[model samples]
Target chain A: MPHPPVHSPTILCTVDVVLLTLTADGLQVALLVRDRAPHAGALALPGGFVRPTEDSGTRDAAARMLREKTGLHSPYLEQLATFSGPDRDPRGWSVSVVYYALVPPMAPDDGAPAAVEWHPVDRLPPLPFDHAEIVRQALARVRSKSQYSSLPVHLCGERFTLPQLKLVYEAVLGERVNQVSFRRRMDELGMLEPMVGETVGGAHRPAQVWRVKEAFRGELSLSERVLAGRD
Target chain B: MPHPPVHSPTILCTVDVVLLTLTADGLQVALLVRDRAPHAGALALPGGFVRPTEDSGTRDAAARMLREKTGLHSPYLEQLATFSGPDRDPRGWSVSVVYYALVPPMAPDDGAPAAVEWHPVDRLPPLPFDHAEIVRQALARVRSKSQYSSLPVHLCGERFTLPQLKLVYEAVLGERVNQVSFRRRMDELGMLEPMVGETVGGAHRPAQVWRVKEAFRGELSLSERVLAGRD
Candidate 1:
């Protein structure tokens, strides 16, 4: 059989990032106003076209876009999925290698710039292209991973109490996790390191401040059992 | 801050599949010999460049390539990762969206074509390009996911007994899983449905034959607890 003529057209390639954080309101994602056509001035995920001259790979492109656009360095950024199609982009057929980032809560007084907007993930407004679906998948990945891994800890500060960490898990999972079961699972995961002599004020006792172990900062420590939730 | 000039060069995008199956020799991956220049005649993952006019998306491209190249319809095909870089491929800066497919054991008499070679995953030949690393990542993903999901069931046939399914899990995991624990975990995952009036030969008694539920054919049912392994 004769091979079909190779049709390798100029496929538009780009990378988009879903920056997520824990805020007082709840789980929120950072959005930026597009400066170029196709969706100029509309809110969208922070992204840009892949530059072969500069980026070594797609993850490098995602990290560079996150730093340049948000002015925030994420400790946990993962490739969520690659979205592609003919109708997704107006200029031509395109592919967007998407990533989701997690950061600790920003200082309340240090308000974000006008271009960067933090919107609740569940209540995002209409976004351009297939970004809405992208955010939905990112959120689902974060939530599902939070169940069996130490993923939500990225949303906590370098040092945090167990109660604070539990709150972060609840925020990410959107469900109340059983206290005892959470502690047991955390022990099994072995992801936390106690900050020696560090204690924080608590309602009943001085709580020990803990941080994620150095080894598990970039890679998540998975649990053998899922976190039990309060029904 | 000055805006950087956009340099969107043509990125060579393609899709490769790591078709894996269970044989007496262990886990093996399907590979094809390269036919064109730039490592022509070398064994490599079955792949091709994206066709914008034909493929609606990258996944569509992957399905199309699998059908045309392997002559096998994969029931479980999932995107593993997107490998990219300037140095990996000799042609130019490229991106390869990879997917891993699982199949059951084929009859010994029905030998694969000379073009299609099934190499033991652990002991692979020097594959062209970054095909080796792609296979490594695909294998790691399949093994890791097998711990808490019904992913290994895809390596079993349409009708399987509990004992037969356990062996498949052991093969994919490369570890001896406890019989009692394996059965309990499978029950908790709830992916299998009993084929009424069907029984298979067993060591002690006629064992009930089962098949994966229709709902889980495309998706895996995850177990909250990991499959226990004996020391």
Candidate 2:
């Protein structure tokens, strides 16, 4: 008879989110302070175990986790990367599916359950586990995504001025974009339309506000012009 | 005296690669056969344990495993996602970080050490674990990335005809693209330049070949014009 073969060990799985929102201060992200061990009292991304019922599919699990933790329904979410090192967590060898989500800046509802708070991205506190590194990677992905797609709009309110949208893009990309060029590009992409009877007041001028067109909701694609000079 | 709490079992960590290449048969990907218990002898993505190394990162471990399993050297690799579930594997709880890589096609070296083979993307056999899902997600990402950036060039030879380049793009995207539109888009991105002395024999006429410009390396930004549809 052949001898029995040895088998590899099992691993624990979890999902974490880097939820971004544009704020007056700058680009902000939601983080939670762990109230348990392994990284007790340390800042971390909002996450939890993947329930068995939620494991019907890959995207399903991620979506479920996102909604449960953030209270945002079907937000713009993309898989960032996974963090699975032996020492990433002191408990054991665990793997985390990290996702990045873009949401409009708004105060949480009175019934929002998670013990989390939004921190301006530029001033993030040290995070638990390998979360600080995860946040960095997520921001990089957001910056890259903003260049080709209309994802920055997801971080702004429903009705906004072109300058407000431009500021969101600049905040995420960490660069000063030419105002004229930015508006021209947005108009070309059909990302915005003049809001009916809407104006935003500033110091000297009342800027016309615009809302994202419905047709452009799921039509985001990478821009070839931006790719040309990226390298 | 305070009593310590009972801890959960230890989790195992692993890394898997969605190794892709461009071949005469269109896009091809490498798959391995698991020879041990727990999906034994089943087709699977090439992967291995994450060794306890002080210097190597998660991606570094993935690259090392990919190089060891496949004879190809990949210059383009990105972290796809992590798979973790209590019962994903019958053996125990296990988490796997999946990485996607694009490699140029070539015959396997005689000294290559793994029992790996490349299968056309359209005719892939059933894979072990959750590898089939990993491949699907990786392909989707590759297609989306190709639309904005010149990433598909990494899957082609250093110098390739426009027809060959177009075919590669279509295969990854799973769609038929208008040749005139595709050519115009490529030209506007400035990703490729006409080669001085390269021609490929075709039935009717000799097709001119183009080489990817060196200045585009490591520049993965998308074009504003492409998004705006100005070109």
Candidate 3:
């Protein structure tokens, strides 16, 4: 007779976050040190188990994980991708629903998780598991999203200068951009509006501050014209 | 005493597919009839367990599962999302990684260990597990991707007419498109070129056939102008 299966079937679910924030240096990501049994003592994306609740869905689970891991509630959170491989975790076969979150940079509390730290995206340390690969994919999606959508605004404060916005894109895409072309594109998209009372500090030519159009909030709609030839 | 903390805990991992194809009626999806074990007899996206492989990564595993289940090869596949909840799989704690795939409208032999059939997206049957919800999310992503990318081309044959191409978009998006606007957008994107030796069969007019542009072959690149809203 054939041997019966050994273990009781179980579903292993967890949430992982790609928390992106804009800093003076450039775009940065928050990473946490794993303190528990699986992958302990390694730098990884902040995440945790999904809790059972009446109103909690996948998005809610992601939000909960973000808050628990980073102590910051981002205004924008979207599902990035899911990662599951038989050998992804040595402990067992676990599947993780990954999310990409955008929030303004903030200081972590003193009592926060001991291993958590903000690392500039370009100079990231070795991440645990497939996290480094996850981050890379998330970054590519973010860069692609920022180009056609108003997502770049999420990386900056409510009030920001054009130069600041340009810098965010440059950092995320890892390249230099032409200011004239970038401004022209922004104007055509109607994504930005000149702020009434703001200007860049400490510059011979004070750059005008602009805010993302409030009416254009939420996810940007993909337009036919934009799809045609606009990047 | 608690069983001395059992070592080498086992977790279940499964692969789910969001198989999309373009047909005359519209975009359709392939679902399989669950025949054995959990969710038996219910219609579900075809899925199976990951096998042990030394060189297989997550993508490779997904591709293998897809090929074995659907008899399709080299289809456009991407990680959609992961569904891992304690109660998601009644058999036990199961973790499933969902992948979205785009295949042209050609019937392939069902190689899965289950009864499989294609159903128009709008008339999908009740699905097993939380698969209906996963399909909905995947469809939404496909629609979004189709708007800005040449992704819909994947739903067509190696060569096709402009009308056939337009119909693919109409079916996937569930909306009628203006002929002039659609053609203009296609031309502007450099997605296709008129074929010299072919003509579409029709009662009223002999329309010219078109092939996907040579330059637009392989994975399409997002244009900076399109990204920056210069159209």
Candidate 4:
């Protein structure tokens, strides 16, 4: 094997995204029904094969598929893991670069493809291929990073009250966080900015809305002791 | 494109491993010199194209490469990230599923093809392709995860004292850790077990040697507030 085999088997290379968004019910994952065979009509992550000529990177391909399926571009997108197994796909040895995309609440209407829908992360329907495992890994990454990083902010809208942010955190973490401690931690993180003229009326009173600081918007930022007791 | 294309581009798929090991000086990474054209004889991470038929997963491929190049199977091998870009490989659009493998102290002797050498992580020479970036990401993940998870323990020998473990952590983290806090955090993690009859002679006294608990041997375990003040 001194000379490498130029005609090595051509394997299928694709990207799958676990697009997560926070809804009134809980954290929902955006999925699309596979229209073609192998698992036709089965709900799958909104993704497609990485076009060798066009895609600069798998991240770009994932972002493109996300935009085409959900009509939204994620503010926070990261590669969750790469799932490549001999038996994972019926089509030869396929490698799927799994990514998790986080977006604010939006109408998942990419038109014509009415199959794109948001399903609660906790109770997803049967997913095709190894998507269930992909989703589980994505959820683990999101939850683990949320403990110390400013990641959950991407799931919130442009403006949100502290209570709303806490709800988003609770949904992702699956635990009730101490309000005062969470607030203190957020304040110490300094990743949020108050929306001066925005206030949402709640049952108790008017709550001021906050947006993630511009510096922390493009990439992830970490804070020490963010989840002190929760972790 | 309702129907998928049957002749999707034959993208080049490969795996690159960042193999880290503890050395007498400090933490070092193993590298191999490429033998073929396009950057022959340049230092590169130990890697090869995924043999689609033989490999069960990218992780298995990476581990095989580790064994072939270094003659040691890593106890802590994980998928760091997938680095794929149009310009990454000169041959074609290539996707490199980068992985990081950690091992205890070992001799990296692969006989005749003695191209593999361990270089200090902090002072690495120029590497081929996007391997430098892969190393950077792997190091960041190791440092970040070591703060909370039982990751650095794998870099130590089978039996090590608390001081030896602290040195391993400091080397991976690039900072000195407080001895008291480190011990307390390790105790809370419950990922280490003392060997009843093992003790290493030190200047002051004989120190009890500990090994990672059996339950947490092959996987990473996390603790709350592991690096309480170090972070």
Candidate with top lDDT is: 1
**How should the candidates be ordered by DockQ, best one leading?**
4, 1, 2, 3
lDDT of 2 by residue, A88-112 (tens): 7665556677888887876767334
lDDT (Cα, tens digit) per residue for candidate 3, span A1-231: 333463533444567889888888877888887887566788789887655542144567788776666666546888887776556766444557788988766655534454558888889998877888889989988887765556767777778888887777676666776787677657667778898767887778887888777776555533233211223
Estimated TM-score for each candidate? 0.92, 0.71, 0.73, 0.92
State which candidate, 2 or 4, has the greater TM-score: 4
If the candidates were sorted by their TM-score against the true structure, best first, what order would they fall in?
Answer: 4, 1, 3, 2
Worst 10 residues of 2 chain B by lDDT: B222-231
Candidate 3 lDDT, tens digit per residue, B1-231?
222232432456677888888777777888877767666778788787765442144567678867776777768887777766556776544556788888777754434333457898889888878888888989998886666567788888878888888888777767776777677667767778888978878768888888777676556533233211222
Candidate 4's displacement at residue B221, Å, is: 1.7
- The alpha-carbon deviation from the true structure for residue A60 of candidate 2, after best TM-score superposition, in angstroms, is 5.6
Question: A159 in model 3: Cα distance from truth in Å?
Answer: 4.6
lDDT of 4 by residue, B95-200 (tens): 9998888887665353424666888988999988888888888998898889887899889878899999988888888788888889888988888999998898
Clashing pairs in 4: none
| Model 4 iRMSD vs. native | 4.7
Query: How accurately is candidate 4 docked according to DockQ?
Result: 0.51
True contacts kept of each: 0.56, 0.40, 0.26, 0.64
Q: Which ten residues in a row have the lowest lDDT in candidate 1 chain B?
A: B1-10
**Model 3 chain B, poorest ten-residue lDDT window?**
B222-231
lDDT computed for candidate 2 = 0.73
User: By lDDT, is 2 or 3 better?
Assistant: 2
Show where candidate 3 strays beyond 4 Å: A1-14, A34-42, A48-64, A86-94, A108-114, A158-231, B1-12, B37-39, B51-61, B84-94, B107-114, B175-231
